[model samples]
Target chain A: MTGNIFYFLTFLTLIAAVGVVVSKNPVYSVLFMILTFFALTGHYILLNAQFVAAVNFIVYMGAIMVLFLFVIMFLNMREDTEQHKPMLSKIAAAIAGGMLFVIIIAALKDVDTNVYHPAVFDSQIGLVENLGIVLFRDYLLPFELASILLLAAMAGAVMLGKREPGERNRF
Target chain B: MELSVLLIKALIIVAVFGVTLLIATYSTYAERKVAAFIQDRVGPNRAGPMGLLQPLADAVKLFFKEEFVPANANKFLFIAGPSLAMLTACMSSAVIPFGNTLYINGEYIPVQAIEVNIGILYIFGVVALGVYGIMIGGWASNNKFSLLGAIRAASQNISYELAMGMSIIALLVLSGSLSLRVMAEQQGQDLFGISGMNWNIFYQPLGFLIFLVCAFAETNRVPFDLPECETELVGGYHTEYSSMGMGLYLFAEYVNIFVASAVMATLYFGGYNFPFMYDLGLPHNVVTILGTVVLFVKILLFIFFFMWVRWTLPRFRYDQLMNLGWKILIPLSILNVVLTAGAILLKDEFFK
Candidate 1:
């Protein structure tokens, strides 16, 4: 039953992801992408990574998707004026996507699945207690560094996105 | 062999999710009433006793309302925008531990939908992606105001997320766990036998303060609600949205607020824990039920507090919001982490 659920979720995710790339409408593409994220969250739940799945919902579905929707609504691009790109560009894009997919599949095929068994750890290890202990004691430095990276990103976003007082007059 | 257990877990999850959705629906009514009262007017008292049935009425009204597609709007994206907002908002509650485990028929069943080890990080990661929904919706609307609103929303979320992550790191340093249950367990134990001193808020007061502020900004509540600031961005991102589309965007915001409040209570307020919980040593069923109730009450109180602040404070300017997030909160949170580490190290060596 679990395997069936996992396979179903994986299939749904791939389908939606492909829809995202192929859809004519940009908004449809984004909506499909959001569906793709939701399906991926289901996969995480199957792996027993409940926290990661919830976060997947929270971060991707909550913050990022909201932003995407907001942008799509704001632009209000009329379909009548939206001309399809040349066939050459479309073919090039399709070929590139196909090549990437093939490369990934080929790489996965070489893996020796028979030689591998899932590593055994205490079931409690995935509980808040064990993860906390590992995060604080062993991975403390990296944990702290992640916050710093976020800070840097915030700074970059502000500097790049915000309009300067002098520059506003030109508009 | 264990199909029953899984079934029970699924049932509980559905129940909690259903209840939360109901609460979110009413929260909109409550917000309108509260906003009215704050502005010195009678709130919705017409729809059922004192507006008790207002939410249901509103839902019906929205359902029957004519769906308007702008003449120039991208039809496909226009439809997708609000749906994404609603979907992402409701998804974050899945991993939260609502209560303790109840032992039934020789088996221990946890009350949470699921217990994932990296719960905190997972929440942060998912919330980061939520910005995309607004961005896509606004950009798709083909309205400049919507675009501006979307940009503001994106900028605000990205800015505040940094400080929020930092504040959480400080808490992680002190608590030494990412799992909500373990964090709750730690809070239940008294350090040095101090009565009623079991919460993380007492130990990491500064971290809690920063986190609370960041939560407000993250949810796009008032004071930090620049994304939807009416005077400037002309209804922000959802200006062109009508009928159920607009309803979805509005509903999603409240749901996000609910999720944020729940996370705050879980992280710093001992989740479902209460003082002298060990003294009762109650039956497993009672314990689980009581924990669930306590968690709900705490979340409600946080929601009330959110509304209270909305009426009390004026919205922050865009630049002011960014400066406060980056300049003040981020630095202070970093200082908190360093200080907490030193304090913990000292306590281990000298106090022992």
Candidate 2:
């Protein structure tokens, strides 16, 4: 049952990821991206990484994607309004995409699929308590550093978004 | 994971679904009755005994009404919108524990749909997704007012969700768990010699206040109903929706209210844990049944409070809503988290 579910979710994720790229309307692309996130969350759940699954659902599918949709909706993107690219540019894009795909395939070729043996796997490792201990104990510095990076990015965004004292409403 | 266990979980899920829909159906009647009482009117007395069957009548009316799709609206999304809203609204109830464990044939079965460890986070994720239905509906309508309403909803929900999450952080710190069932179980402790009265409301009042305010905003209740404020935005996101599409959107609001009330009761008011619950020498099963009743009472009271506030309070302006969410609630909830952490530290250092 679990294996079937995993395969199904993987198929869904692939389809939705392709949909995100190929959808002409930006809103449709955003919706497809959300579906991709949902499928990835299903995969996380299948792996018994419930904490990671919930966080993925909340942060990526919930918060970030909503902002993406919000911005795309404001842009008023429609299929009829789309500008067609030149034939040369389309070929160039295809070549760029194929090269990136080949690079990913080559990088993943040596990955050891046998590393995650079901017999030796610790299902409890993905649980919240165990993950929390691992994070706070062994990976404390990296986690804190990541948080600081997020904080710096947030501060930069605020600084950039703020208007000057004498500025008028541009719109 | 036995077949019997699976069957019992399925039963509970169906039961919870039925009860949620039933309550949401009646809440419309209750809201109108409550509004009438507040405004010195009789309110729907003709449907049945004090409008008992009013909601049923309303449901029939809604079903029989003309289903409308705007001329220029995106047909697929216009249909998908309310379906998504209703879907996410119902999804959150699965994580809530309605009562204590039931002992049947010497097996312990929790009175909940599912018992995932990340229960609270699951609900949060579902609630966040609820905004998508409104956004899609409004944008699909291709109406300026509907689009504006969707924008308001998206921004309001995002802004308030931060404070709501911050407020919940304080509760999580106190309870030391993300599972709503665990939180409810933790509150089943004795406090000040009173049995089963150690509610988190006493410990995290500030957090509860912030949470209540944000809940209003997140659910798009009164004083924060700028998204669908009839005066400024017509029917808001549902302006172009009609018949069952509009009905689903409206019904979803009531379901969301019901879920929010249940969460608040479970988190702060000692869900199914009334004072003297264990002190009475009642039979175990009887106590469990009584506890479920008590939990529903608390939930209904909170629902009534939702309606009471809806009628009593005036709506906030758009800018004021933004200011309150960003400038006040966020900072206050952060303070609540700091206070909770400090208290926890002090208790560990000195009280222990």
Candidate 3:
């Protein structure tokens, strides 16, 4: 049953992700992307990563997507008058994406799948307690470093958005 | 049969999501009424008794309202924007532990919809992605005001999320666990037989404060509501959205507020735990029910507090918001982590 659910969710996610890439309208693309996230959340739940699934919905779907929608709405973008991408660029993007996907699949193929030991999936491991232990005890420094990266992103955003003195009509 | 177990789980998940949706809906009504009350006026009493059915009325009105698609707007994205908002807003409650486990016929049923290691990180990761919804919506609207609002919202969320994550780090260090259930269990037990001092909030008050402030900003509540300061941006990112699209954005904000409150209650306020809760010695089912009720009550109080603050404080200026988040909160959070570490080391060396 779990396997079936996982397969279904994966199918939904991949299809919507493709839709996001292929859709002509940016708004439709964003919506499809959100759908993709929803499907991904389902997948996470199937994997027993309930916290990740919930956060995926909250952070990505709730916070990030809201920002995206807001930006798309605010920009009031007109239909693209620009011509479609050159054949070379399109082919290049496709090739790169295909190569990356192939590489990922190839990398996974070598892993020993038959060694799976199905323990009574302890709910405690996935609870906030275990996550806290791992984060603080093992990944504390890297976690702090992520904060630094966030700080830098904030600085960059402010610098980009700020109106410098005597820079009128800058758009 | 396994099928029966799966069905039960699915039903529970759907029920939780449904209840959250209902709460989100009513929150909108409550917000307006509270806003009116704070401003000293009769709130929406016409929809039903005390305007209890105002949300339903509003939903109907929104449905019947004429939908306007801007001439230059990206129609697909414009429509997708609000749907994304509503969908994502409802997604975060899956991992929350609503109550303790209930034993039925030798089977133990966990209160949470799903349990996962790295639950807190998952919350952070998903929340990080929420900016895209606004960015896409705002940009698709093809309106300058909307674009500006979207950008503002994105920047605001990204900024505060850092401090928020930092605040969580301090708690993580002290709790020595990441799973909400484990954390709650730890908090439930008194430290070294000291009564009423087991909660993380007592040990890490500064971290709790920082997290609370960041939570406020994360939810885009006032005074951090720079993205939708009506006087300037003219409804901000949703300027071009009408009817349900607009409603979705507004409703999502309340839901996000609800999620944040739930997280706060779980992390710092001893989720579902009350003073001397064990003393009651209630039946297992009753205890679990009481725990769930306690959690909801805490969440409601937090929601009320959110409304109260919105009425009490003025919105922060854009630059000021940035300064507070980056210069003030970030540094303070860092210092808090250092202090927590020192305290931990001292305890290990001297007390141990």
Question: Which candidate achieves the best lDDT against the true structure?
Answer: 2
* Rank by lDDT (best first): 2, 1, 3
Locate the minimum summed-lDDT window of 10 residues in model 2 chain B: B1-10
Deviation in Å, model 3, residue B301 alpha carbon: 0.9
B51: Cα error in model 2, Å: 1.4
Candidate 1 residue runs with Cα over 4 Å from true position? A1-114, A117-171, B1-7, B191-197, B281-284
Q: Which regions in candidate 3 have their CA more than 4 angstroms from the true location?
A: A1-171, B1-11, B191-197
Q: Best candidate, DockQ-wise?
A: 2
lDDT of 3 by residue, B161-246 (tens): 88998989899888876688878767777666653237778888888888889988878889998888899999888998888888
The digit string of per-residue lDDT tens for model 3 on A1-171 reads: 888888888899899999998877666777788889989888776766666676777677766776666566444444565367799999999999999999999999999977655685565554444766788999999999999999999899989988889889744
Docking class of 1: acceptable
Clashing pairs in 2: none
Predicted structure with the largest TM-score when compared to the true one: 2
Taking the true A–B contacts (Cα pairs closer than 8 Å), what share appears in each candidate? 0.62, 0.88, 0.42
- For model 1 chain B, give the 10-residue run with minimal summed lDDT: B188-197
lDDT of 2 by residue, B195-246 (tens): 8899999999999999999999989999899999999999999999878999
Superposition error at B237 for model 1 (Å):
1.4
Instruction: Report the CA-based lDDT of candidate 1 relative to the real structure.
Output: 0.82
Candidate 3 local Cα displacement, residue B226, angstroms? 1.2
